[model samples]
Target: MKAKELMDKEFVYLNCDDNVVEVSKVMEEIRRFTCPVVNDNKQLVGWITSFDITKGLREGNEKIKEIMSSYEEITTIHEDAPARLAVVLTANNKFVTVPVINDDNQVIGMIRSCDIVELLSELYDIKVYKLYEAMQHQLKGVTWEELMSASALVSKKTTGVKISPEDYEANIMNATFGEAIWATGGLEKFFAGLISVGEMVIARKVGKARR
Candidate 1:
């Protein structure tokens, strides 16, 4: 897959002259953590993240340029770059989102960690809901069997709870490989123990389809 295939085109951005107030408004409205900053020449100059904006407000009247991360220091990838490269950069930088630039250095789009994870999930044919619940345990170093046991407890506690297929798909698509396995195991055991005996059978079918 290419970066262009997964990049978000309708992203919010900021101009160098834009004030903290304006930036704050945009971030709030869009619920985004960062925005690309451009110069009057329509060239990419820097990026303003929520953290930078908040710091600027604290300092009172600090220009966007003052708090923004310089374009030179920010890592960028061309649209044609392999999707694996994007995953590597995201993992290495711990970035929630990264900007995409064209040959002219013009900002074309942005890619989020969530998007990459989701793409991988779909390619792997994993269930999103199980993946998410399992990841929480995996992060805590919980074993597969232990994680399954815990999931059963939670399901029993909330019998009336319902998860939409879209939400489930999103979770599976967005989770990493290790995380997906952990989540699948957890959810499979939970459903089997609490809901039905056919849970694992259904999961296996989905897994095969994803491949």
Candidate 2:
């Protein structure tokens, strides 16, 4: 598949000068951490996220441009580019999605992580699910964020147990991190183990869907 094929044209974006507070509402409404930033001409100018909002809020920055990852700071893929490039871009830069552009460099659509995940599942005939969905029975009404936050505290003091996103996803239910989660005293934690705070961030990333 190519970027144009994978990209979603019907997606939410933010204006470069939009209020910082607006991005928070956008993120909340879209249930996504990131959004493409565009100029008045609708050309891709940058990107913004909850992380930027937190930083901007701390510094009292009111404009999206103040904290957005500018064009020079992000990697955009051509509409016809191979989809795997999006995977590489996200892997190297921690982007949740890649903006797809036309020959004019106008923002046309986006290749989201969830799109990639769905494609992979289809191509491989593998069963994949959001961790939160998979753990519905285990949660017992406790939110994933709460249980994850409680479990995430384990890495702060533990000496040397690092779990990368790839490792955690591939072995989340079986990872030794479960032990640490249990250590954190979460009554509804997954696998009854502990994990890294970093992976908790990754867990959230994996939880979102395109729709």
Candidate 3:
């Protein structure tokens, strides 16, 4: 996939001249701690994170320009470039986030590592099989929610398996996390899908009790 296809076009960004308070507001609105920084021309300049905001505020460096990573210290991927480029940049950053830019060096979108994982889940059609693999590994100190989410991918069949209340809390919630990783396209449309999955789990239990 191309960078544009993988990037979140409906993304929030920051201006170098923005203050820490302004950055905080942007983070609150987007529900994301990280954002790309742009110049007066709206060109990609650097990146900022919640850490930067706090550090700046604590140090009395309220202006984003004084705290945001400089353009030389950051990276950018072209919208028309291969998506893998973004993957490398994210992975190199310990799988954080990367910004996408157009030919004019204007910031266009952002891509998080979770986005790539979801893409893989969609492309590979991963399913319940991963859950079994995780269980086999005897993953300890690990919550069921994280396990099921990392393993479960896109699948049409719930297989009539019922999940109890405990299981729902452990697994179903994270099923919603990372932007509902199991379903692509992020957040907005995932609610219906979430409800459908919950109903399926309940139905499975009902069917079992009847048997």
Candidate 4:
């Protein structure tokens, strides 16, 4: 995976002339702790964070260039670079986000530490049997409405198991994460698959008990 593949295209970047007040609003809207600063040429000049804004306030409203961390202090990764580079950079620098740039040094996206964590978590763990057992033990009384909602999600997403819920529960219970993703279609499909399968099993049990 490349940095661009994992980076968030929707991010906030400010011009050198931008002020704290405007920067704060943009940051709040994006729910980001930091953002990059750029010059008129769209080349990265520096970056700023909430901390910079706080310090700037003490000195009164100042231009972003005046409050921003110097370009050298901020690190950037090329969009074509390895995805792990973002994780390594963030881990080493204690960064919550890193800027992704193209060859022209124009900011294209932001790589978030949280996104990397999610991808890693999905990719690493493979205890499908444990997950299935836990689901069976814990989700015994899960409601029909919840199951229906999951079905709706799968239908809308067009990503989960196309087989009937019964088959999904029986056959795919022990499928590894990657296998499940392949069987389904994407990462989001796994949750919906779980719900749908669980629903089918519980519904069968309830029907048998009634008879």
TM-score of 3: 0.57
RMSD of 4: 13.2
Scored by lDDT, model 1 comes in at: 0.70
Per-residue lDDT over 1-211 for candidate 1, one digit per residue giving the tens place of the 0 to 100 score? 7888889998876887788887888899998998888766556889888899888888886478878888887888888888788899999989988888888778889999998889876745654445545554434433444434444444444455554444444544565555544654764554444333124334544566699
Worst-scoring 10-residue span by lDDT in model 2: 123-132
lDDT of 4 by residue, 8-110 (tens): 8987779988878878878888788989898877788899999998888788966888889998887899999999889899888888999999999999998
TM-score of each: 0.59, 0.56, 0.57, 0.60
TM-score pick, better of 3 and 4: 4
Go through the candidates in order and give the C-alpha RMSD of each one to the true structure.
Answer: 12.6, 17.2, 14.3, 13.2
Candidate 1: the clashing residue pairs are 117-174, 118-173, 118-174, 128-171, 128-172
lDDT per residue (tens digit) for residues 55-76 in model 3: 8878888788888888897777
lDDT of 2 by residue, 1-211 (tens): 7889989887777887789987787788878777889877788888887899999988999989888988997779998899889988877887788889998888999888888888765633322224434554454444555544534354334535664444434544443433434554553443333334435544654565332
**Candidate 3, overall lDDT?**
0.68
Off by over 4 Å in 3: 126-211
* Full candidate order by TM-score, most accurate first: 4, 1, 3, 2
Off by over 4 Å in 2: 126-211
How many residue pairs clash in model 4?
Answer: 0
Query: Which has the higher TM-score value, candidate number 1 or candidate number 3?
Result: 1
TM-score, candidate 1, is 0.59
| Model 3 residue 41 CA deviation in Å | 2.0
Which residue segments of model 1 deviate by more than 4 Å? 126-211
- lDDT ranking from best to worst? 4, 1, 2, 3
Error of 2 at 64 (Å): 1.1
Error of 2 at 123 (Å): 2.0
